[model samples]
Each structure stands twice: as C-alpha cells, then as structure tokens.
Target: MVGIVVVSHSRKAAEGIRDVATEMGGDARVEAVGGTGDGRIGTSPEPISRAIADAADGNGVVVLVDLGSAVMNAEIAIEEAELEEEVVLADAPVMEGALNAAVAAGAPDATVDSVRMAAEDAQRVKKFG
Candidate 1:
C-alpha cells in the first residue's frame, strides 16, 4: 500500500488531519510533518523528509500541504530525501485529499500514481449542494 504525508503550518492542523485520515485509512501508512519544528507557525523541510522516510512503504508516498511555504518546503524535502521510493506532492485540499489518498493507499494493491490520483480526484468531489 502507498503511504501518505501531511504538511501544514500548524502542527495541530497536521495532526488533526492525520487523526481523521487515520480513522478513514484503515492500515495505511500516514505521517505528519508540520510547524517550524519548534511549536511555531511555519513549515520546514527537515522534518518533512523524515516524515516521508517514515511514512514511505514500497508503494511510495503522497504529500498534502496546507499552503505557502509548506508546499515549497515539501518539494525541497522530496528533492533532498533522494528516496528510492517516489514522493508526490498533491495540489488538493489538505484534509480531504489526505483522507482520500490514505483510504486509497490502504489497499495492498494501491500504487503511488493511483494514490495520487485519488487525492487529485478528491478535489473534484462535491460534498453537497
């Protein structure tokens, strides 16, 4: 199954999204890397790489970010990690995308691309009118 990483300026936000994803993901590999690594409001590449490494399975990892530097930092983290497994940055709603990706990724047969597609597809979903 693919893995998932959540990135946000707020550690609480990241952890909250991870908690919800956890409830929906079943056995998926999900991890969160957020804040300035000092309980501040910001994003950094350092812990992001660690989270990617920790979350990554043989199926790779999909990263979801809140905004601004979180996306930029996540990109840098992926580049710096130089991981053998692929890391994809998702341009979708952080909470919803992570939940969708996590659920899709929990399947043993799920691939990195498929999990990413799930996150992307999540953006198109309409909750209600």
Candidate 2:
C-alpha cells in the first residue's frame, strides 16, 4: 500500500485535492501539506515532511506538488523526512495526478515506483471538453 502526499502553496487547495482523492475510494493513506506556518502563500518543508510521515504506512510515499516553491519544498521535505519508506515526486498536475496516484496506491500490489508512474501518466488524461 503506497501513500500519497499533496503539497501546494495554498492550504485549501491541497486539502481539497486530498478530500477528492479520499472520496474516490482507496485504502491508501492520503495527506495534504500546504501554506506557510503563518498561513502565508508559501510552502514549508517541516509540515510537508510530517505529512509524508503521517501518510506513509511502512510502504513508500508519492508526492504531488502544486507549483512554484512547492516543488523545492517537497524535495526538501523528502530529504528531511528521511523515513525508511521511499518518497518519490511526480511531475504532473496536482489534483488529477493526486487522484490517479491515490487510485494506484489503493491497489494491494502498489509500489512506490508504480504509484509515481501512475501520477506522472495522469498528464495524458484531458480534464475538460
């Protein structure tokens, strides 16, 4: 069971994405980390790391980032977390990728690399008409 971590510059956006992923039905652990400690429009590594720890249930974790500093912060968090579970970053759209990853994570045989690939492949699915 792979877990997912959503990182965004806006707290609401990250949490909203997590809610949707959760509602989609998955056994994976999903968590969101966003906004600065002061609630400013920025990302922090500390909370992001904690989110990864919280979501990871021994299995590795996959991270989906919104944009801008979120990427850098996620990378930092991955290193800072330093958990035994491997953490991988997906280069895909935030919400869609998170949902895709969550679905993959739900699989009984989901792996960190597989979940990351699923999230990255989400870029192929068009969102609108």
User: TM-score winner among the candidates?
Assistant: 1
**Residues 1-129, model 1: lDDT tens digits:** 688999999999999999999898878888987999778999989999999999876678899999999989999999998988889898889989999998998776788888898988878878897
Q: Give TM per candidate.
A: 0.95, 0.94
| Global fold similarity of model 2 (TM-score) | 0.94
Stretches of candidate 2 exceeding 4 Å from the true structure: none
How far is each candidate from the true structure, as Cα RMSD in Å? 1.0, 1.2
Task: Please report, as a residue range, the 10-residue window in candidate 2 with the lowest summed lDDT.
Answer: 21-30
